[model samples]
Target: MVTIKDIAKELNLSYSTVSLALNASPMVSKTTMRRVKEAAREMGYKPNAMARALVLKRSGIIGIIVPDITNPFFSSVAFGAEQAAHKRGYNLLICNTEWNDELESHHLTLIVEKKIDGLLIASVNKKNHLLEGIIKQDLPLVFISSAYPSARCNFVGIDAEPGGYLVGKHLTDLGHREIAFVGGKFNSFSVQRRYAGFIKALADQKIAFNKEYTLSGEFSIESGYENGIKLLKKFPKVTATMAADDLIAVGMLKAMLERGIRVPQDFSIVGFDDIFIASLPGIELTTVFQEKKLMGELAMNILLDELNSGGDSKREKKSIVLSPRLVIRNTTAPPHSE
Candidate 1:
């Protein structure tokens, strides 16, 4: 609880002189600055962040709002963001929405009320009006994963359609005709883009799209497990399945294994986002790799640039769309060759 007043008393200097010395003001002599710093360090004196923020109008804190922290994809993104924030001498406040719009709004309000320097949001829905309000306020906000094309805000996301197309093309090249798509809720742009790409690829190859083979639900392992069971029972002739994410693929894989269906022999699976567990000995998931860490780092850098620039110029909002790569593994093969 030591304050600048305590440091001034210990050094026999006035409070104004101590404040100028601690702040490295040009008026303070070098010798006085050194003595003040030494005394403050010795006494464990720390400036109040609230007072500093009030004076500067910036908390030096960035807020990140994501849909689900339990998902490994978001966790990786958070790690990269934290690393970049720390490197630039800033702190991060992460809020998990659990795909709830109300909670997301609450977190956004709190972050704005706290006067954070910037915001990094991965919204639950693409067309959220709440995000529009934030943009209208001229907040330094960056959208990740889900974004509206009409919004005049900075966004960093991947070309999900092309990535999904790649998955479908890979499967088709491997002679998978009866392909199924396991995706998250239909409202997500990521899911929709991936599905569109998959459908496009299939149509190009003269493979007819079947409604019975498609399934959608929450992007969770349990949802994947339940959907996998339903898809397998309903479409026993399905040869290949492209999952929207690694978690869904893993869940489906577990269900297939439990049902005594050998992967790549009975069914081929392709997943998106090459998570850490995707390459495990048992899983060996053949999937699309989205460079999530790089995305997070770039988002932070963009926010910092905007904050430092003081919103003076109308910088062209950047829409970075990273390309996804296909990681070949043991999970995918020519359908029913075994």
Candidate 2:
């Protein structure tokens, strides 16, 4: 509760002199600055962030919006952003949208109202008009794990097509022709790119893709579990499957195991984003590693660069696409003859 006025009264110094000394302004004598700092420490004076932000024209706060915090992949991305922002004396305000577009838009509006220094959003949809509007306003914004090519804004995401292609090639290499894809919403750019790459790999192997075998839902364990059961029961001949993400893969794996299916013996599963759960002793899910945390770190770095540019008219737009690597684990293997 201690203010500069209290310090000025206690030290019998002019309010202007005390303010200059507290801020280490060169206009104040070094001795005066030292004394003012000492008094501040003794009086338990804490600087007001809002007051400081008003003077600097920046909040020193960054806002990050994710589809779902319960998903480990998104959580890792947030953690990376937080760490990077903290190192530079900035704090992060995390907002979870639960994969709803309405919530995402609402959160974006709230963040803008707060006058955040910058923003990092893992968009709920592929093409967002709201995001485009924000970009047009020249806000320092970065997309994490997703991007819209037409927007020409800052984005940090993984090479999803290549990651999907890797999974498709791996499955085909293991002699899995009767395959299926259980993924998130088909409208999602990440899902579309991954499916495109996967289909290309299948075409390379001269295998025709069956639209009936493709399933789409939210990128959640529940959706994965439900679709997985449906796929296994309906197709019966499928020997392997590729999941859009680790959560989906784990869900499908659980569903299969619960039905007394032997993984890698009766069926093979591959997932994306090698989340922590995928590496557990019993799971060991084969997946494509997408550098989840690094994606977040890179997105925050891009935002930081834009924020520090100080409203330069020639500010450069940046996009970072990280490569994906396949991690062979216990979940994938050559198909066995029935």
Candidate 3:
């Protein structure tokens, strides 16, 4: 029931001055701003978000779409984004697509309808038609963790190819000549880049890259378990393997253990994304450390910058790629000798 008009009347200030002070406009003196804010708070005044959005033409809300929030990696990224958004006086509208393309498209359409100021997506597909349309509409969009290769937009993530190379080099250095790669969807941008880096590392060491040793599936523990089983049956001679993400790595580890294979003694495993669950007491998985929270913060910050720029057509697109480091844990070690 409290309104800015009431606060302005109580403070004996003009409507415009009170409004500017409430907005924290630099034009208002800091002393006056503080006074107005204190009075407003004491009067139990609350902002009318709908009216404010109508006036400013912005919702002060950022939309984020991720494949799966259940996955610790994406959840961590979302947490970082939420913190960043809160610091800017903005709220987040999060959507989980469950790694489904249709759900992703549906969420995009629904979010645009909600009049969000900006969008961030860890997309399921490398290129989406609906996303292309959204880009042409000039909405501020940023890619987090995943990217659309054909779109000219802002993106923030780790340099995945090098991350894969690190795993490959680490395994090879430990005398793992017959290593395999088990990853997510083969078409996804992250998977492709990681696979490329793995191959490059093998070539550098003059180790033959065997297509038979590669397996691609969904970025889930279930999929990882399935592929892990397949890998064991098809090529039991392999000494080590790398997974696309921590979830997949954990899944693969389970399959190996269930089959009575001792980790690091029978086979070594490396994963991407040093998620929280990866560092558990028994499952200390070796993985590439992606600054998950940092990635989210950087992505949100980029979106804020673009929003502040007022949709400048001349503004250059941004691509922030962070470096990746390998975190050696209990899951990986030198190949075993009978």
- TM-score each candidate: 0.84, 0.85, 0.88
Flag clash pairs in model 1.
none
Compared with the true structure, what per-residue lDDT tens digits does model 3 show for residues 185-288? 88878888888899999999999988999898888999999988999999989989999988899999999999999897899999999998899998999999
Ranking under TM-score, best-scoring first?
A: 3, 2, 1
Candidate 2 or 1, higher TM-score: 2
lDDT of 1 by residue, 185-245 (tens): 8888888899999999999999998978889988887888898899888998888899999
Instruction: In model 2, state the lDDT of residue 144.
Output: 78
- Alpha-carbon shift of residue 104 in model 3 (angstroms): 1.7
Evaluate all candidate structures by whole-model CA lDDT and list the values in order: 0.84, 0.86, 0.87
In angstroms, give how far residue 292 of model 1 lies from its true place.
Answer: 0.8
- Candidate 3 local Cα displacement, residue 163, angstroms: 0.4
Could you give me the TM-score of model 2 versus the true structure?
Answer: 0.85
The TM-score measured for candidate 3 stands at: 0.88
The per-candidate count of clashes, in order, stands at: 0, 0, 0
| Model 1 segments more than 4 A misplaced | 1-55
Report the C-alpha lDDT of model 2 over 1-338, residue by residue, as the tens digit.
99989999999999888876765555778899889989988999887777867766888799998889999999999999999886555789999999888888888788878888888887656565676677777788888777876767788988789899999999999999999999888877888899989999999999998988899987888988998899888999999999999999999999999998899899999999999999999999999998888888889877876776564435778888888999999998999885
Which whole-number lDDT from 0 to 100 does residue 183 have in model 2? 86
